[model samples]
Target chain A: MGPLVPQEIIGADWNLFIAFAIGIGFGFVLEQAGFSSSRKLAGMFYGYDTVVLKVFFTGAITAMLGLLFFSLFGWIDLNLIYVNPTFLGSAIVGGVIMGAGFIIGGFCPGTSVCAAAIGKIDAMIFIGGIFLGIFFFAEGYPLLKDFYMSGSMGPLKVSDVFGISGGVLALIVIITAIVMFKLGELAEKRWPREEY
Target chain B: MKTKYMNPYLAGVLLGLVLLMAFFFSGRGLGASGAVKSVVVAAVDVVAPEHTANSGYYSKYVGEGKSPMKAWLVFEMIGVLVGGFLSGAFSGRLKWKVEHFPGITANRRLIFAGMGGILFGFGSQLGRGCTSGSALTGMASLSVAGFVSMMVIFGTAFALAFFLRKNWI
Candidate 1:
């Protein structure tokens, strides 16, 4: 009923096709959300614009809730879905590096690709940088192999860590997001700078 | 010129719905860096099959009876390009231009963009996914990795935002 490819509900060929369609939606929403602009994205940190926080948290919460509901309705098998494995040390280290890249480059891989499509030089550069970065990692894999594989916590969920239900966690996230949204709006007003 | 953006909450809802559909239909979330990895693997496989086969990092992706480019992420990335183009066109943002801060030259911006990209690329591999795959989709599943990655990414960016203030602010 769910996870078409993994469960053999859909053929391999259709998997990529579905991925393409999902990607279209992902790209469309990203652009519409003003994710195509580096200045707009960077504003999240400067307190000038909180669009990043608003959209990001909203999206995360929305999906979290959706998954919970889907599971309850038996519409999708949450267990069938892929969960990114946690390698604590690498996750933190990689995330930190990417954060620096985000602020400095002004785009993540997805946003960079979307921006590149709309003729953004910065985005294109970011994409190029991503390739170079991957290439560098490939070439120097030996040097970072140990750290990359360190801190294996297996695949675990935040809910599991807290010994709470997914629904409860989702509820908590929604409430936190609401509070943050209010604060974000306040920060924007307090800082109020020119739009990029 | 007026810059228009969709309502944040609405857009977020729409994005969430899309993510939900992804799970319902494919039992997976969205991704971006994986596509690039496919491209890298394919390119390396074509140019230096032996090298890719011998390498610990590249060999895992390149194998017999398979084309690296034929992965799910790659096709989705192609879709992302088309969808982004359509959205930009409809929104009147499909113009060809270099976006940068006034303080920096276009060349400087491009240079940093490339450098930043390189760092992001490397980081994504180490981190196991990029923003879309790791943070957004990961968080949706309530995966600890996802939350941790999200914190690292945003926290690091916030920490460094002051130093790079001129680049954006």
Candidate 2:
């Protein structure tokens, strides 16, 4: 019942307001964590900073745990939340393409938005590229329509695939993140960056 | 100006709390590219109403009295811009400049940045979401798409990092 808008617990007008407030929190946290810098973002791959991995996994796990606890405590209904449907082909292929894009552009869409807001010219160009690329996709939809809709897996969860409960899976993730953070700390020490 | 950024772990915690709050209130996760898609569809519709109406793809978003600008992600992203600007201003990082590896020319960097953006934009459509939507938010909901997309995106980047060393390293 806690999905206030969907459950009619909150008015429709509050939807956009909540979105705005959440976005502010998201953007603030992203920028305050130094996500505006490309070098710092790419550091996850290079082991120079590794803040990306640490922050990323930590955020994911924190939310995962929070949601689980909320569900348990009757604060929110888990079934109301939207889960991304799994498309085997598009998920891998699209992600691969985006990954290549990440290294080349030095920013993901979200981080790019944050960077662009901070007056980053490269990020602005990246934003332009996003529109151009999307336009190309939209125009070429006829040719790629079949491929895009090829995979049709329902909203599957990793926990179910692993035959474990969300709490258990989250626990493992927390433990793994702890180990990764230690390694990340070592990596940052081993390969320090002059900037960011 | 405060140059000190929040500790990464703390920032992560804050970000997580935001995501959780989003789920609690919206029954959905955060997104970035979906808003761009709305803008793109609306732009096309405005520029060529006939074409947008004719196309199966663009027609879904346009021609239905549905203003793409009136989307959740769109409003949230406006807030993102404002919040980002505020953070940058407070930190004294709000200067207009191009950032790149020292080894690469500015032109090369910009060109690659565009190319990457192009690929990501298209790929996000193909994948049905961007890192924030499909990966981060998906993970929060424990969806398989989240894990798969997150792995593939980061894994591919790791695999290609050596080849693109001049760009980042």
Candidate 3:
């Protein structure tokens, strides 16, 4: 009933069309959540605005719980879902570099696209930068082959790493998010900003 | 601002619902960088067919009756563009301007934006995903890579935010 594409519940071409629709939903939510602004995004780090934290955690947990329930109701087969594979060294290294980019550039790959759609010049440039970066990596693939393939730990779950069930882990994350949300409010109140 | 945006919590819930829909339907979460990678692959193929085939990275994405642009992520990205445009129109934020702090010049903002994009782009490829692909989607699936990527990205930003404080707050 679920994972319509993988299960052939939808045809190949139709799967792509569904992907487009899903993408629209994703982008619409991102912009509505004020994710199109670099300043608003960067503010999460400054304690000025923590909308990123609130929306991001809320979205993640919501989906996590949704999957749990969907599987429980026998609507979706959890095993068929695509899990992002773990490449330990690369994930940490790549994320650290991206973090630097987020603070300095103020827009990530996804957010910049939304911002660019609304005619944000900086976002346009950011998109260009992404192109250049990918090009550079592609050309330098020979040099990066080793590091990129290092720490290949195949699709492993965080819960598996921590010796817990997905439900238990999801609950733990929800609780942590609640605590963080409260702290985020305090931080924002303590240090308010006039800009959006 | 005469009007305000949606409530953060509500937006989060709606966003989560969207993510849930993605999983329920496609068995995959949202992504942005993968689409761009397809574009790059397609561009290289068009520019140098022989070179694309010869390259280690480019060849994998090109050839065998495949158009790099014909990927799920690519189509999804098109939807993202439309959705973003619609949302901006609805919110009256569809203006052409360079957004920057009063403290920084437009040129400075664009420069930093490009530089940051370059880093993010490279990292996404190396990390095999971006904020949406690796962090948000990964975390929801309870993947260890997702947690590690999320923590590292945010933690690194938190550590560097003070040094770059002049740019935002």
Once fitted onto the true fold, the runs of candidate 1 whose alpha carbons sit more than 4 angstroms away are A193-196, B1-3
DockQ of each: 0.83, 0.83, 0.85
Q: Is candidate 1 or candidate 3 better by DockQ?
A: 3
TM-score, one value per model: 0.97, 0.97, 0.98
- Chain A TM-score for predicted structure 1: 0.96
Give residue A42's lDDT in candidate 3 (0 to 100): 87
Q: Each prediction's Cα lDDT score?
A: 0.88, 0.90, 0.90
In terms of DockQ, the best-performing candidate is 3
Position B136, candidate 3: lDDT: 93
lDDT of 2 by residue, B62-118 (tens): 755678888899988988998899999888998998998898888998998899899
DockQ of 2: 0.83
State the weakest 10-residue window (summed lDDT) of model 3 chain B: B1-10
For candidate 1 chain B, the 10 contiguous residues with the lowest summed lDDT are B1-10
RMSD of candidate 1 to the truth, in angstroms, is: 1.5
